[model samples]
Target: EDQVTQSPEALRLQEGESSSLNCSYTVSGLRGLFWYRQDPGKGPEFLFTLYSAGEEKEKERLKATLTKKESFLHITAPKPEDSATYLCAVQAGGDSGYSTLTFGKGTMLLVSP
Candidate 1:
Protein backbone atom coordinates (compact mmCIF):
# COMPACT_ATOMS: atom_id res chain seq x y z
CA GLU A 1 0.00 0.00 0.00
CA ASP A 2 1.07 3.58 -0.64
CA GLN A 3 0.67 6.00 2.21
CA VAL A 4 1.81 9.39 3.50
CA THR A 5 1.92 10.72 7.05
CA GLN A 6 2.56 14.30 8.18
CA SER A 7 3.80 15.35 11.59
CA PRO A 8 2.59 18.03 14.01
CA GLU A 9 -0.97 18.26 12.82
CA ALA A 10 -0.99 21.94 13.62
CA LEU A 11 1.47 24.78 14.11
CA ARG A 12 1.29 28.39 15.20
CA LEU A 13 3.76 30.98 13.97
CA GLN A 14 4.25 34.65 14.45
CA GLU A 15 4.78 36.85 11.44
CA GLY A 16 8.20 36.15 9.90
CA GLU A 17 8.72 32.94 11.82
CA SER A 18 9.96 29.98 9.85
CA SER A 19 9.87 26.21 10.34
CA SER A 20 9.88 22.90 8.53
CA LEU A 21 7.31 20.11 8.39
CA ASN A 22 7.91 16.45 7.69
CA CYS A 23 6.23 13.93 5.44
CA SER A 24 6.97 10.24 5.56
CA TYR A 25 5.82 7.80 2.94
CA THR A 26 5.73 4.15 1.94
CA VAL A 27 5.35 3.37 -1.73
CA SER A 28 5.98 0.42 -3.97
CA GLY A 29 7.90 2.64 -6.36
CA LEU A 30 8.34 6.33 -5.96
CA ARG A 31 7.35 8.47 -8.90
CA GLY A 32 7.11 11.97 -7.52
CA LEU A 33 6.73 13.97 -4.35
CA PHE A 34 4.30 16.89 -4.38
CA TRP A 35 3.81 19.74 -1.98
CA TYR A 36 0.62 21.77 -1.82
CA ARG A 37 -0.76 24.65 0.16
CA GLN A 38 -4.46 24.99 0.81
CA ASP A 39 -6.42 27.76 2.37
CA PRO A 40 -9.72 27.23 4.13
CA GLY A 41 -12.58 26.05 1.89
CA LYS A 42 -10.41 25.59 -1.19
CA GLY A 43 -8.51 22.95 -3.06
CA PRO A 44 -4.76 22.56 -2.67
CA GLU A 45 -2.44 24.80 -4.68
CA PHE A 46 0.62 23.12 -6.09
CA LEU A 47 3.91 24.21 -4.63
CA PHE A 48 6.75 21.91 -5.52
CA THR A 49 7.57 18.56 -7.12
CA LEU A 50 10.53 16.39 -6.25
CA TYR A 51 11.27 13.41 -8.46
CA SER A 52 14.28 11.69 -6.93
CA ALA A 53 16.51 11.49 -3.93
CA GLY A 54 18.56 14.64 -3.34
CA GLU A 55 16.20 16.59 -5.61
CA GLU A 56 14.50 19.75 -4.47
CA LYS A 57 12.09 22.46 -5.62
CA GLU A 58 11.25 25.85 -4.25
CA LYS A 59 8.77 28.68 -4.70
CA GLU A 60 8.18 31.92 -2.91
CA ARG A 61 8.94 31.32 0.74
CA LEU A 62 8.73 27.54 0.63
CA LYS A 63 11.21 24.84 -0.30
CA ALA A 64 10.69 21.11 -0.67
CA THR A 65 13.33 18.41 -0.61
CA LEU A 66 13.09 14.68 -1.14
CA THR A 67 15.02 11.68 0.09
CA LYS A 68 14.74 7.92 -0.27
CA LYS A 69 11.96 7.58 2.28
CA GLU A 70 10.68 11.02 3.10
CA SER A 71 10.30 14.66 2.10
CA PHE A 72 10.49 17.95 3.93
CA LEU A 73 8.80 21.34 3.40
CA HIS A 74 10.69 24.27 4.78
CA ILE A 75 9.08 27.67 5.21
CA THR A 76 11.20 30.80 5.30
CA ALA A 77 10.06 34.01 6.93
CA PRO A 78 6.43 33.30 6.39
CA LYS A 79 3.84 36.06 6.46
CA PRO A 80 0.23 36.13 7.57
CA GLU A 81 -1.01 35.18 4.13
CA ASP A 82 1.16 32.09 4.27
CA SER A 83 -0.99 30.65 7.01
CA ALA A 84 -2.67 27.66 5.51
CA THR A 85 -2.75 23.90 5.44
CA TYR A 86 0.36 22.38 3.96
CA LEU A 87 -0.05 18.98 2.36
CA CYS A 88 2.38 16.40 1.06
CA ALA A 89 1.47 13.67 -1.39
CA VAL A 90 3.23 11.04 -3.47
CA GLN A 91 2.55 9.80 -6.95
CA ALA A 92 3.03 6.06 -7.27
CA GLY A 93 1.60 3.06 -9.00
CA GLY A 94 -2.02 2.62 -8.14
CA ASP A 95 -5.30 1.47 -9.70
CA SER A 96 -6.68 4.95 -10.18
CA GLY A 97 -4.61 6.32 -13.04
CA TYR A 98 -1.19 6.30 -14.61
CA SER A 99 0.04 7.13 -11.10
CA THR A 100 -2.20 8.00 -8.22
CA LEU A 101 -1.18 10.49 -5.59
CA THR A 102 -1.81 9.63 -1.96
CA PHE A 103 -2.11 12.62 0.31
CA GLY A 104 -1.58 13.26 3.99
CA LYS A 105 -4.34 14.96 5.98
CA GLY A 106 -2.23 18.13 6.22
CA THR A 107 -0.26 20.34 8.58
CA MET A 108 -2.30 23.38 9.57
CA LEU A 109 -0.26 26.56 9.96
CA LEU A 110 -1.58 29.67 11.65
CA VAL A 111 0.42 32.87 11.44
CA SER A 112 -0.35 35.82 13.68
CA PRO A 113 0.61 39.37 13.05
Candidate 2:
Protein backbone atom coordinates (compact mmCIF):
# COMPACT_ATOMS: atom_id res chain seq x y z
CA GLU A 1 0.00 0.00 0.00
CA ASP A 2 1.11 3.55 -0.69
CA GLN A 3 1.83 5.66 2.36
CA VAL A 4 2.89 9.19 3.26
CA THR A 5 4.29 10.72 6.43
CA GLN A 6 4.67 14.39 7.24
CA SER A 7 6.87 15.42 10.12
CA PRO A 8 6.20 17.88 12.88
CA GLU A 9 2.41 17.83 13.02
CA ALA A 10 2.53 21.54 13.71
CA LEU A 11 5.20 24.21 13.33
CA ARG A 12 5.44 27.65 14.87
CA LEU A 13 7.56 30.32 13.23
CA GLN A 14 8.25 33.99 13.56
CA GLU A 15 7.18 36.31 10.76
CA GLY A 16 10.56 36.39 9.13
CA GLU A 17 11.73 32.91 9.99
CA SER A 18 12.35 30.37 7.29
CA SER A 19 11.80 26.62 7.45
CA SER A 20 11.24 23.44 5.47
CA LEU A 21 8.37 20.94 5.70
CA ASN A 22 9.09 17.31 5.00
CA CYS A 23 6.88 14.81 3.16
CA SER A 24 8.10 11.25 3.07
CA TYR A 25 6.30 8.72 0.92
CA THR A 26 6.45 5.09 -0.10
CA VAL A 27 4.74 3.68 -3.20
CA SER A 28 5.07 0.75 -5.50
CA GLY A 29 5.49 3.06 -8.48
CA LEU A 30 5.53 6.78 -8.23
CA ARG A 31 3.64 8.83 -10.79
CA GLY A 32 3.72 12.22 -9.16
CA LEU A 33 4.18 14.05 -5.92
CA PHE A 34 1.85 16.93 -5.12
CA TRP A 35 2.05 19.83 -2.70
CA TYR A 36 -0.84 21.95 -1.47
CA ARG A 37 -1.67 24.71 0.96
CA GLN A 38 -5.01 24.77 2.77
CA ASP A 39 -6.50 27.43 4.93
CA PRO A 40 -8.97 26.61 7.68
CA GLY A 41 -12.44 25.73 6.28
CA LYS A 42 -11.23 25.87 2.70
CA GLY A 43 -10.18 23.19 0.29
CA PRO A 44 -6.51 22.70 -0.39
CA GLU A 45 -4.96 24.91 -3.03
CA PHE A 46 -2.51 23.38 -5.47
CA LEU A 47 1.09 24.38 -5.02
CA PHE A 48 3.26 22.16 -7.15
CA THR A 49 3.63 18.83 -8.89
CA LEU A 50 6.93 17.01 -9.18
CA TYR A 51 7.14 14.10 -11.54
CA SER A 52 10.75 12.99 -11.30
CA ALA A 53 13.67 13.09 -8.94
CA GLY A 54 15.65 16.34 -8.94
CA GLU A 55 12.62 18.21 -10.20
CA GLU A 56 11.60 21.44 -8.47
CA LYS A 57 8.87 24.08 -8.63
CA GLU A 58 8.48 27.40 -6.89
CA LYS A 59 5.88 30.05 -6.38
CA GLU A 60 6.43 33.19 -4.40
CA ARG A 61 7.73 32.14 -0.97
CA LEU A 62 7.22 28.42 -1.46
CA LYS A 63 9.51 25.99 -3.23
CA ALA A 64 9.01 22.28 -3.70
CA THR A 65 11.58 19.62 -4.45
CA LEU A 66 11.14 15.93 -5.13
CA THR A 67 13.34 12.91 -4.74
CA LYS A 68 12.81 9.20 -5.13
CA LYS A 69 11.33 8.66 -1.69
CA GLU A 70 10.39 12.09 -0.42
CA SER A 71 9.61 15.72 -1.17
CA PHE A 72 10.25 18.95 0.67
CA LEU A 73 8.42 22.26 0.78
CA HIS A 74 10.78 25.12 1.54
CA ILE A 75 9.33 28.32 2.91
CA THR A 76 11.63 31.30 2.84
CA ALA A 77 10.97 34.24 5.11
CA PRO A 78 7.38 33.46 5.86
CA LYS A 79 4.70 35.85 7.03
CA PRO A 80 1.44 35.59 8.91
CA GLU A 81 -0.35 35.25 5.61
CA ASP A 82 1.69 32.14 4.96
CA SER A 83 0.19 30.31 7.89
CA ALA A 84 -1.74 27.35 6.59
CA THR A 85 -1.95 23.58 6.55
CA TYR A 86 0.52 22.20 4.07
CA LEU A 87 -0.51 18.93 2.52
CA CYS A 88 1.43 16.29 0.63
CA ALA A 89 0.07 13.60 -1.62
CA VAL A 90 1.43 10.94 -3.94
CA GLN A 91 0.04 9.40 -7.10
CA ALA A 92 0.87 5.77 -7.74
CA GLY A 93 0.79 3.92 -11.02
CA GLY A 94 -1.64 1.08 -11.36
CA ASP A 95 -2.78 -1.43 -13.94
CA SER A 96 -6.24 0.11 -14.26
CA GLY A 97 -4.85 3.04 -16.25
CA TYR A 98 -5.84 5.36 -13.44
CA SER A 99 -4.06 6.79 -10.46
CA THR A 100 -5.09 7.53 -6.90
CA LEU A 101 -3.69 9.88 -4.32
CA THR A 102 -2.52 8.88 -0.86
CA PHE A 103 -2.18 11.88 1.40
CA GLY A 104 -0.37 12.61 4.62
CA LYS A 105 -1.91 14.12 7.71
CA GLY A 106 -0.40 17.49 6.76
CA THR A 107 1.69 20.01 8.67
CA MET A 108 -0.01 22.97 10.23
CA LEU A 109 2.21 26.04 10.01
CA LEU A 110 1.54 29.06 12.15
CA VAL A 111 3.58 32.16 11.42
CA SER A 112 3.24 34.90 13.96
CA PRO A 113 4.15 38.42 13.17
Candidate 3:
Protein backbone atom coordinates (compact mmCIF):
# COMPACT_ATOMS: atom_id res chain seq x y z
CA GLU A 1 0.00 0.00 0.00
CA ASP A 2 1.11 3.59 -0.64
CA GLN A 3 0.52 6.43 1.76
CA VAL A 4 0.81 10.19 1.27
CA THR A 5 0.68 13.11 3.66
CA GLN A 6 0.48 16.86 3.05
CA SER A 7 1.13 19.59 5.57
CA PRO A 8 -0.64 22.83 6.44
CA GLU A 9 -4.03 21.81 5.10
CA ALA A 10 -4.63 25.43 4.13
CA LEU A 11 -2.39 28.36 3.34
CA ARG A 12 -3.10 32.06 2.94
CA LEU A 13 -0.65 34.27 1.13
CA GLN A 14 -0.63 37.81 -0.16
CA GLU A 15 -0.17 38.46 -3.82
CA GLY A 16 3.51 38.39 -4.72
CA GLU A 17 4.35 36.25 -1.70
CA SER A 18 6.19 33.01 -2.05
CA SER A 19 5.74 29.72 -0.20
CA SER A 20 6.10 25.99 -0.49
CA LEU A 21 3.77 23.00 0.05
CA ASN A 22 5.03 19.63 1.18
CA CYS A 23 3.95 16.09 0.32
CA SER A 24 5.52 13.07 2.00
CA TYR A 25 4.91 9.53 0.90
CA THR A 26 5.70 5.88 1.43
CA VAL A 27 5.30 3.48 -1.47
CA SER A 28 6.60 0.21 -2.84
CA GLY A 29 7.96 0.09 -6.37
CA LEU A 30 7.28 3.71 -7.16
CA ARG A 31 6.66 4.41 -10.81
CA GLY A 32 6.03 8.18 -10.73
CA LEU A 33 4.86 11.07 -8.64
CA PHE A 34 2.40 13.64 -9.97
CA TRP A 35 1.42 17.16 -9.04
CA TYR A 36 -1.90 18.78 -9.80
CA ARG A 37 -3.92 21.92 -9.23
CA GLN A 38 -7.64 22.09 -8.65
CA ASP A 39 -10.13 24.88 -8.38
CA PRO A 40 -13.38 24.89 -6.52
CA GLY A 41 -15.98 22.70 -8.27
CA LYS A 42 -13.50 21.53 -10.86
CA GLY A 43 -11.39 18.48 -11.56
CA PRO A 44 -7.68 18.45 -10.96
CA GLU A 45 -5.39 19.83 -13.65
CA PHE A 46 -2.06 18.14 -14.25
CA LEU A 47 1.01 20.12 -13.35
CA PHE A 48 4.07 17.93 -13.31
CA THR A 49 5.40 14.39 -13.28
CA LEU A 50 8.52 13.42 -11.40
CA TYR A 51 10.08 10.04 -12.01
CA SER A 52 13.20 10.19 -9.87
CA ALA A 53 14.96 11.94 -7.05
CA GLY A 54 16.53 15.30 -7.86
CA GLU A 55 14.02 15.80 -10.66
CA GLU A 56 12.26 19.15 -11.12
CA LYS A 57 9.59 20.75 -13.29
CA GLU A 58 8.24 24.26 -13.54
CA LYS A 59 5.31 26.16 -14.96
CA GLU A 60 4.44 29.79 -14.50
CA ARG A 61 5.05 30.62 -10.83
CA LEU A 62 5.10 27.01 -9.67
CA LYS A 63 8.07 24.70 -9.33
CA ALA A 64 8.08 21.08 -8.20
CA THR A 65 10.88 18.98 -6.76
CA LEU A 66 11.12 15.34 -5.80
CA THR A 67 13.33 13.34 -3.47
CA LYS A 68 13.48 9.74 -2.33
CA LYS A 69 10.85 10.24 0.37
CA GLU A 70 8.92 13.37 -0.48
CA SER A 71 8.02 16.13 -2.91
CA PHE A 72 7.70 19.89 -2.65
CA LEU A 73 5.63 22.40 -4.62
CA HIS A 74 7.04 25.91 -4.52
CA ILE A 75 5.02 28.91 -5.53
CA THR A 76 6.89 32.08 -6.38
CA ALA A 77 5.38 35.51 -6.50
CA PRO A 78 1.90 34.21 -6.70
CA LYS A 79 -1.12 36.17 -7.81
CA PRO A 80 -4.74 36.10 -6.74
CA GLU A 81 -5.55 33.93 -9.71
CA ASP A 82 -3.14 31.35 -8.42
CA SER A 83 -5.30 30.42 -5.47
CA ALA A 84 -6.22 26.76 -5.68
CA THR A 85 -5.82 23.37 -4.06
CA TYR A 86 -2.59 21.63 -4.89
CA LEU A 87 -2.56 17.85 -5.02
CA CYS A 88 0.06 15.15 -4.85
CA ALA A 89 -0.39 11.61 -6.12
CA VAL A 90 1.87 8.66 -6.64
CA GLN A 91 1.61 5.73 -9.04
CA ALA A 92 3.07 2.46 -7.83
CA GLY A 93 3.20 -1.02 -9.28
CA GLY A 94 1.65 -4.04 -7.62
CA ASP A 95 2.07 -7.83 -7.87
CA SER A 96 -0.80 -8.13 -10.32
CA GLY A 97 0.87 -5.86 -12.87
CA TYR A 98 -1.53 -3.10 -11.96
CA SER A 99 -0.85 0.43 -10.83
CA THR A 100 -3.00 2.86 -8.91
CA LEU A 101 -2.74 6.46 -7.79
CA THR A 102 -2.53 7.12 -4.09
CA PHE A 103 -3.33 10.72 -3.30
CA GLY A 104 -2.86 13.15 -0.45
CA LYS A 105 -5.67 15.34 0.83
CA GLY A 106 -4.16 18.40 -0.79
CA THR A 107 -3.06 21.83 0.36
CA MET A 108 -5.45 24.67 -0.31
CA LEU A 109 -3.75 27.96 -1.07
CA LEU A 110 -5.51 31.31 -0.99
CA VAL A 111 -3.60 34.15 -2.55
CA SER A 112 -4.91 37.60 -1.77
CA PRO A 113 -4.34 40.67 -3.79
Q: What Cα-based lDDT does every candidate model obtain?
A: 0.91, 0.95, 0.95
Report the error of model 1 at residue 31, Å: 0.6
How many clashing pairs in candidate 3?
Answer: 0
Which tens-of-lDDT digit does each residue in 1-113 have in candidate 1? Answer: 88899988999999888999999999977889899999999999999889999998888898899999999999899899999999999999666558878999899999899
State the lDDT of candidate 3 residue by residue for 1-113, as single tens digits: 68999988999999999999999999999899999999999999999999999999999999999999999999999999999999999999978878889999999999999
RMSD of 2: 0.7
Which 10-residue window in model 2 sums to the lowest lDDT? 93-102
Against the true structure, candidate 2 reaches a TM-score of: 0.97
Tens digit per residue, CA lDDT, model 2, 3-113: 999987999999999999999999888999999899999999999999999999999999999989899999999999999999999999977858988999999999999
lDDT of 2: 0.95
Worst 10 residues of 1 by lDDT: 93-102
Compute each candidate's TM-score over C-alphas. 0.94, 0.97, 0.97
What ordering of candidates by lDDT runs from best to worst? 3, 2, 1
